[model samples]
Target: MKKLRDGPMDGDMNGNQRTHNFRFLLALAILTPLVVSMTVMGLATFHFGRLSVGELTGTIVQQTVARVGAQLKQLQDVAQDQNRLNLKVMADRPPRAGDFKRVAAALAPSFEVNDELDGVYYGVEATGEFFALLRGTNQVVNLLERTLDPDGQWSRRISRWSGTDWQFLEQLPADRYDPRTRPFYQAAKTARATIWTSTYEFWPHRPGDRRTTGVTCATPVYDGAGQLQGVWGVDLGTIELCDYLAAIDPEVPGYPFIVGEEGDGTRRVIAHPNRNMVIDARTGMLFRDANGIRDETVKAFLRQIPGRFAAHAVHTASHTVPLRLSEFAPDSVAARTRTFEFADHGTNYLGGCFVTGRDDRLLIGMVLDKKEVMRHVNRNAAWFAATFAAVLVASLIGVFGFARRASRPLVELQREAHAVGRLELAPSDPPLSHIREIRELGNAMALMKTNLRSFRKYVPADLVGDLVRSGQEAMLGGERINATIYFSDIAGFTPVAEQLRPEEIVEHLGAYLQAMSDGIAQHSGTVDKYIGDAVMAFWNAPRPNPAHAADACRAALANQRQLDRLNEQWRAAGKPVFRTRIGLHTGPVVVGNIGSEHRMNYTVIGDTVNLASRLENLNKLYGTRILISETTRAEAGSAISARPVDRANIKGKTTVVTVYELLCEAEAETPEQAELRRQTEEAFAFYQRGDYARAAAAYREILQRWPADGVAAALLRRCEELAAKAPPPLSQDG
Candidate 1:
């Protein structure tokens, strides 16, 4: 028998220990240089790949943006040419009152020839009269005339083109909408040349007609004597312009948008791929107030270059850059075209900015997701990495067969570690290793897996799964997503807590929260966090739920019903009963695990969350148990029965949001509850429309039927106060 060294082989050692020692050191020495060389080569390959991909992608994006810019410039030029040509043809001899019809007939052919022109009009400054031919539809044309009266008043006459002849439509009421006051008219009068107006909504002849956004090209018309007479203009509908912008190749993975300077020196979005991004979501109105724009990308562009651009620099970065928007305003650098980079919600983007139109006021920009653009580069890089790794593994296998045999136990331990990293811990006995260091490594990995198993209980399982799948220890950033947030708080928890002992309070509160959490979990909602006596949860995050809004509403109702059962049990046990108020709102929010490096929490933030909290607190004002925003009600559909509470301008937000009280499930409502809901809706409708007296009567009727209805009673008081304080009507004589 031979004696063996425990720790290391000394000058004299046993045959087995020496053999193992030599093989392990030899394998390490061989693998070290191989890994080092492969890492250096891989880094170099990745660096060059990024450069080549970035350059090619940037060039393609620049060309696409430039092409869009050129098309926009061509549109402007066409408008100017049309305006100049018509002005010259009319200026050859100024048109008198009788010659107006001839001038209109001369312009009528222009519309038939040019499909780009939506309308042709000429305004006479001398007579305060206007004649125009507008395209009502693809086949129908309308002729409009505004005549000045002897008393300096104006009235409009509309005639429809019925293919064979012009049919008289009707005379419109008098209004102060004057063509002379338009920006295009003013600009042409001031510049004495053909000029283009900023895009604006053009209303049709009929009342309550949908308005189409368009641009006008106008030129001041003068007689042979060079005296200013009137302005001749042509209208170009933005439908064609928007269509052109949207028709850009989908393969490009970028969108083109047109920005124009408004009269107030604010930037307006003239064209966008999704028209709703340019319009107010709540109002369905196109945004003219730049500060009121909700689109963050558009706002960022406008804020970078205020008014007119003289010299602007574009910022570029290879890695993901913070999307603060404020950082986009760069130092002065003059360039006709520039490429930039930005990051939003963990995705990198490349964009190009090109000045379009003659005045240099309009900007055409295209943004592409860098990941989408460099997809081929990433694939190539992956192939290179995989090939190198495979070669390294093959070389190791060929050189170290005996060493691999010695490391068989360690390989099993490595697999265990990987499984632990993936949050898939399966119970297994630690493998025995002849090597002391290898055995200790296996022990440490087993300890880590055990600790991780315990830690999983402290964290949300879904969030843990996300982290494991993403191969990240923790998420540090948030993503903007459309989610429905639910907030619930005990209506009078403070008084209840004060009345009970601390232990009892804790017990009851814990039980209440547990019940509510169960309800939320049943509906696939993530219980984000709990406050002192409140719970906040959300749906459609960490996973997608198409019915997130309806699910949230159902969860809130479920929570209330569950709380009722819990309160009954508490009452039977001689404890305090709890009444919870819940608020639900559906909108865009930023959700992620956010906090310090050491301590983090998965939560949501944004105005949507704030509004939900506000609605939760607002329950006290209306004495309602549940309240939800208009967006939530709309998304909840017919599953939930809700009555309008009020259209309130929440404290922080400028826009008003309509709130509704979640009464019950539509199918579960009794006849009395249905009638109460009907009466409440009618009263609220009157209240919103400023009919306080009728609203008061309606609320009184509801109180007569259901006197305990706190919401109706509250509204009745409000209506009475408003009606009493209302001003007296003006006398007929006055």
Candidate 2:
């Protein structure tokens, strides 16, 4: 009994088995139930967590699928309504055989049904009686329009050879007695009401040519008296529908298909994922089986059908106890399952489902990885066992000295481990464990913390923390933002860029960017993107501010100020000086990645971005260094002093944007400049009144005060030109 008790810590034992020491063995014995219990609890917690997560995920997927299915089903309802409306239109008037030609002509533009499709047609209840054909893609070809009664009072077969392009079919007789043999005629007679038929291939004969088997939809015509008259039908190539479904996922090599058993095993590839992969399903429906993707994935995917999995629960039976095991493939989506150590402070049972679909919805399963669940499980099992073993060993020890010394090393190791997390010490601390195993653990932890700080270097620690906390900025794909766009291009950048060496150019650009970065940050603007010589800046973040536009405007002006200072320094050093022009516009844009997955730029894009660039180009025309859009002006409110530059209808922008030039702070414009601006506003008033003569005179007055003002000079030329062709100025009421 004594040997068995001292077996693990026997001093003379070899090192291989000697890893198990007396005090440590007792600790492990106590920890055994804890570890086993932890493992079992982890499994249970993980299962429940997975159960909840999987249920929620499945619910979301099912709801989305149900929604899309409902929308598609709604499409069928629309088709029914359209068919009913066409029937109503046909019932209103029964066209006589002679009236058929003229009626088809008048109804040619009628889109009473299938607005997105080629065209629509109608047929008669009487077999071979009332028949008519119409063009599908472009025009209507009169197929048949006679009430065919072979020996009736006035049999009309005379117009048979008229040759008005009904080319899809073999030329028809004017009055046909046996039209029931024909597909459309036969189908119409049977339906006697609005009816949709299987895909047809009958060609409507056109000028000197013929059309072949095409999908046709027909509806029986009725008169206002509630009488069934004829059937209306439209014929189209089935390939069109196939083409449409094919566009669902252009990247997927997997093509879509329309699967169903219809009409004597006459299968047809009615539709496909993309137009490029269309197969005539009617003749050759069974084609692709490569990559084991044929019968199951392809067919099931095409039908958008949910699949079943072999569900199972297996309880692991060990010598000590029987634990539980559960698994099932409810969907093909969660294809791969993996086990991982989902541990922070303790071991845990975790199952990672790898699936693909919409929004990672493919891998959707029950979330079984909650911290509290794992915590409860690990503590109950692991902590219980460890404490039990510790107390048991405490009872066995003859005195306190061995127990104290034996446990001291572990306690010290734990303290050091805790200290590493708090950054209280560098990771260079050596493991102080006299035992090799404890020493190895301490060494590994120290190395791990050392590597952790390295990651914090590349990405700012606070920024990464912010991203993790605000799940919205999850460092995956970016989002759209209503931001102010700023485009600044050095006026002589092309010349300066050409003149400078590559290294010098980079240095110059870096300096310029650094300067601009300081100003943009000062005004709460995010430098969204830079286009070589042009700097694209925006306000609103990673964070938001109601003063985004104001910040953007201020940044643009500040950039101008920075450029001026830089140019002065460059000139003093006898370097080529340059001027920069900036344009700012505030609008909503898709601000996200603008490059390949491996390499990307976080930037903004939309019509607003283009408008900002356009406004930047207009800088030379206005002779103003900086321009702000009407939206920017509005956002900045009355805080910044600005003069209305023009009411120009910028290209691509339908509504005229009132362009403004930022002059100074609201309280900072000189009196003379303010007066000149007032005069400029008066000139704009005259410009709106169509009094070009007066407007031109006012512009001349401003030019007299500031002759170096090119804007006044340019406006004067336009006003003078318009004045030569002007109407008299309007009175106040007028």
Q: TM-scores of all models?
A: 0.46, 0.40
Clashes counted in candidate 1 amount to: 0
Q: Give the least accurate 10-residue stretch of model 2, judged by summed lDDT.
A: 318-327
Where is model 1 poorest over a 10-residue stretch in terms of lDDT? Answer: 318-327
Tens-place lDDT digits, model 2, residues 1-734:
13334335434444544444556555556556755775576567655755565354333333332332233234344445555655554446765564555555444444423443444444445444444444433432334444545566323321221243223334344432444455765676685654455555554333433433444556666566767666666554445454444333422111223432233432333444443343434443323221222333333232322221111111122212110011122332222332122332342223232222111111211113344444544455566557656755664463334433456657777677666545444556655766777788777777766765674444323333444345453333667878888888888788888898999898888888879877987887776656787877777765678888877877777778888899899889877777878888888888654667576555677888988888888889979888888888888887777777788788998898888777765666788768877888898878877888988999999888889777788788998998888668768787
Clash counts per candidate, in order, are 0, 52
Residues 150-185 of candidate 1: C-alpha lDDT, one tens digit per residue: 686777888776555567889988766677877677
**How much lDDT does each candidate structure score?**
0.76, 0.57
Alpha carbon lDDT at 362, candidate 2: 19
